[model samples]
Target: MKRVFVTVGTTSFDELIERVTTPEATQALKARGYQHLVLQVGRGSILPDSDSCHELTLEVFRFKDSIAEDIKCADLVISHAGAGSCLETLGAGKPLLVVVNDQLMNNHQLELADQLYQDAHLLYCTPSTLIETLKMMDLSVLSPFLPGKPKNFADFLDKALGVQ
Candidate 1:
């Protein structure tokens, strides 16, 4: 059985937590042999109040410094489109599904999420289609991540110094 870690960063994301803990979503996840569904709520307004939560090993927390430990243990990571979370998940080489929080001011997360999806670097889904997207995800198709910093620093320095 696999584990799933759903992290919403340090901001409230009640909508996301609610969606992931939904009966249908839980059922689908159980079908996929997920043994645990853990939520890093991060001040999120929603709590696991549904009876269906008992159907699985569901855990919720406000925040934790050891997110990488959870991410490392998880077979899959479902997260907000925040860059830190995206980079961490990708850097860990886990199959990630990012849902944009359009309500955030300026909504840059959507841009990052869409760009990563288009690049085949990660998976993206809206609040409405999260479960469906998860069911259809094929981790094999995800592009391997090589951080831009290490891979592009030389090119960046060359451009900055006007060297060939």
Candidate 2:
């Protein structure tokens, strides 16, 4: 069975789950009989309203130390579009689906998502488009876009300072 790991708001797991209509999405996976699904709701308690929908396990407020290991073991990762999560998912060479927080006032995430998407580097979704995006995601089409390693902070400072 294929496994999917989903990480969302720590304190808002219940709210986030409530917002997701995964039953429809899971239907596709269910048809294939792939039922190993896990939700790691960091910093958030599991809501009673969330339905398991097949072989699904819900963990609330998981230890911070275990997150990387959990991500490493999963076949696919579903997470928020925070820069940290994006970088980690990319570093692991895992396919990712990022759902940006709409409540964020400035809409910076939209810009970031657009840039990443334009570069063909990451998959992203807003609340309005999440279901459609999930249905259409082509994991094979994603590829790593690693920036060249910088020599050092001092080198960067020297260049910025115009010092020979």
Candidate 3:
């Protein structure tokens, strides 16, 4: 079955969790041919009432040892804008939609998500814009995330430090 996996990583982003499970969002996902939605809700307080979401099967969990398997199994990934979660999903070569938590102080996530979006690696939006983004998103536009060579970082550091 085609699956869409939503993850909020280790923190709470209750808004994202709630938005994606709304009837409009579920209908949009269904229209796109997704059959199952599995959410890693983290510490979010709102667990969706699955019965209200028609024509889609929903699974919700708070935490897991690793979500690598889930990412691999997904046809698409909706994630919080945490660096780890974004890298993991992008590295898996899945179509990614990152939701930025505007409530946070400092809010570095927005910066990372913006750069990735500009790079065409993924799509991003605020929780309030999720449905519109979902309706408009086309996974075909994304470029596969090609990881840099292991030596690239070391080379950059060497150049910066002026080490021969």
TM for every model, in the order presented, reads 0.85, 0.73, 0.89
The CA lDDT of each predicted structure is: 0.83, 0.64, 0.90
Q: Against the true structure, whose lDDT is highest?
A: 3
Query: What lDDT does candidate 1 reach at residue 161?
Result: 100
Candidates ranked, most accurate by lDDT first: 3, 1, 2
Candidate 3 TM-score, true structure as reference: 0.89
Better of 1 and 3 by TM-score: 3
Q: Over the stretch 60-159, how does candidate 2's per-residue lDDT look in tens digits?
A: 3444755777678777777776666666776787777777777764756567656777777878777667667766777778878686466687798999
lDDT of 1 by residue, 1-164 (tens): 58999999978888888888887788888888887888899987787743458547987788887799999999989999898899899989898988877577577667777788899988887778887876777778889887667648888888999997
Cα-based lDDT at residue 141, candidate 1: 88
What digit string (tens of lDDT, one per residue) describes model 3 on residues 78-164?
998898999999888899999888887487766777889999999978999999998988889898889869798899999999999
Tell me the spans in candidate 3 whose CA falls farther than 4 Å from its real position: 153-164
